[model samples]
Target: MDQTLTELRTVNVIRYVTPLREGGSMPAIVEADDGFLYVIKFRGAGQGTNALIADLVGGELARALGLKVPELVFIHLDEGFGRSEADEEIQDLLKFSVGLNLGLHYLSGAITFDSTVTQLDPLLASKILWLDCLLTNIDRTCRNTNMLIWNKELWLIDPGASLYFHHNWSNWKEHILTPFALVKNHVLLKQASKLNEADVFCKQLLTTERIESIVALIPTDWLKDEPLFESKEAQRNAYTTFLLTRMQHSDIFIKEANDAREKLI
Candidate 1:
């Protein structure tokens, strides 16, 4: 599965659907011209385009690591849409989001995964744990797994919380090796196995070219005006540098994860 995935397709928002007010970002379920429903993350949301950047990079990386992820796409919004009757808050959100937005394919009838009620294969659990650590994802705890069980398989979602360094560029270099301590509380930590093996697999698979491919998926406008970066490509390169450099310290994260796993046992 080392092949590059096709670039995400852009679709026009054919209809303004209901709001899915689960997270702070105010993502909505909208119908696209492709006749498919997508969970679109609006640029007007709290995290703004940076959250979309994380979703593209993290989701693509997860897929490359052989984990299931909803197909990522660009959903175009229109200003006139959703102008009619609606909650004032949602009306404001839709109005501001009159441009390109990040979307994850909607999984109809999919159930939120509850790790407590179900068991997961140790290797699969380890793979997900390793992926989350690589991305420095702090949002995958039991309190909010951010995963869906569709057709009895776990699909990872919501990687917008990673790359936290972007939010504050000062001393960003220090974040590369920042050990992912929050992983100790991850919902699937107890079920993880072969932690060291998972690290090696990710390090080998998540190469520079692969990372570039993932970053390239992000539109240029989204990377603009990023602090400490002059051009869009510069910001993109910063992400590549961070992830690639972080891989050099994979053992530190692996050891931290294993230590936490021991505490769980």
Candidate 2:
């Protein structure tokens, strides 16, 4: 993938359609000025902008690795955008999220993926499993999957729970090269038979330049007031360093995941 293609298109929110209550953060479906509906992740939601950062980094990383991820857009929520909303909680959320937010292009007519019903190719399953491990994503369990079957193909979504280390930067360094033991509970763990091959393919795609480019997509406002770093640049560098280091030590996580898979089978 071309490094220059990392820029996400920005769209102004034209209408607030409905809130997705299933998510703890209460993400909403909104219509953008571009005439498309998006599942908007508010910066002011309970999870805060860290969740937005995770979505941006994780979604873009999946794209770079040739995985299926919805198109990400920077959503501009003009002041007083949701003033007419009757729900107090939603009104407060919209009030705080008056500036930039993150959104995924809404996948209409898509159904929640059922791992038991939908068998996946082993290599493809391995790629998805490997990605979740790399991001330390804890949301893709059998109960919630966080996946969709759109147009007869599986697509990944809702990556906001990833990169939990960023929420508390105090022990961030200790997480580098750490094995993601949680992979055992992944929805597709049983089908991910080609993890090593998936690792090689992903490593070749997520080069240092590509990783830096993905981290650079994070908006500055979201990085502001971070207590851990002096500047947004430092914060970005920390994320890039963490991901690259983890990739270098991919064997640790791969072995961990394989071992976990062994127990299940």
Candidate 3:
């Protein structure tokens, strides 16, 4: 474990609360102390240990990818509140309840997919696609646009569906090959000059070393009995390979956007 993670456990910033929503693999929410907020996720025996590891690994990887994800930490508590009598489980449930209450009264402003990303912003759309590709995130679809926009910035939330690629990876590949027609003719891709800037940004953010490091930080339990390579190093290499492969496929969409732009002119 990283030393920073150990120190983060000691901070008294986290407060467990009740859930605000119910769609994620595990229930969770952000508890704030003063102005700072910490994302707290509850792990019950019902979810099993593997799910907990997935959450931690996915959260860490998102942060490494330069995406706007909330800060996460494990909050410990005494048993007797939920199943297994484990303090960890009890603390998680408490935090979830608190988060639900807070979101209901306070952060009532909600943004839906109908108004998220406009069809004109092909460059921004491409950037999002590239990030999703690198992370093997298969849940960002038309109906469940998990990305939220508040204060003019995009924030990623509810990643409980990522990393378990065995379930949705095939669906993701099908979509990537066909491409989303709506974003194909976006204006941002029309300007070749703008793509150079986006390409640069992507290159800077998704480095091989950083990807490998993030994969290493994922809890080993999440990969249990999965068809992936046995060793951690091998698993990291495999994940990196998957990300690169997805990026290659995404390039075709970018090219299509460029072609559409040329036709328009």
lDDT of 3 at 217: 53
Of the candidates shown, which would achieve the greatest TM-score relative to the real structure? 2
- Superposed Cα deviation of residue 100, candidate 2 (Å): 0.5
Candidate 3 local Cα displacement, residue 93, angstroms: 7.8
Could you list the CA RMSD of all candidates, in the order they appear? Answer: 1.3, 1.1, 7.5
Per-residue lDDT over 1-265 for candidate 1, one digit per residue giving the tens place of the 0 to 100 score: 6567688899999876788888788788889999999999998888888888889899999999989999999889988776883688888888877888999999999998898887888888988988888888989988899999999899999999988878887767898998889889889899887887777777788888888888778888887585577777887888888888888888878888999999989
Off by over 4 Å in 3: 1-15, 24-26, 30-39, 42-66, 74-122, 167-200, 248-265
CA lDDT, every model vs. true structure: 0.86, 0.92, 0.47
Worst 10 residues of 1 by lDDT: 223-232
- Residue 260 deviation, candidate 2, in Å? 0.2
Q: After superposition, how far is residue 240 of candidate 2 from its true place, in Å?
A: 0.3
Clashing pairs in 2: none
**Residues 1-265, model 3: lDDT tens digits:** 1212221232232444544454544444445444444444444424443444445555555565565655554444334333432566444554343211111112335454343244425556556554544444556665676666655565566555544553433343344354334443232333233554555577666566655565565445444454444675565455566655655566665555456556756
Give per-residue CA lDDT, model 2, range 1-265, as digits (tens): 6645547999999999999999689999999999999999999898899999999999999888888999999999999987899999999999999999999999999999998899999999999999999999999998999999999988899888999998889999998878988888999999999999999999988999899888888888888566778887898899999999999999999999999999999
Question: Candidate 2's error at 155, in angstroms?
Answer: 0.8
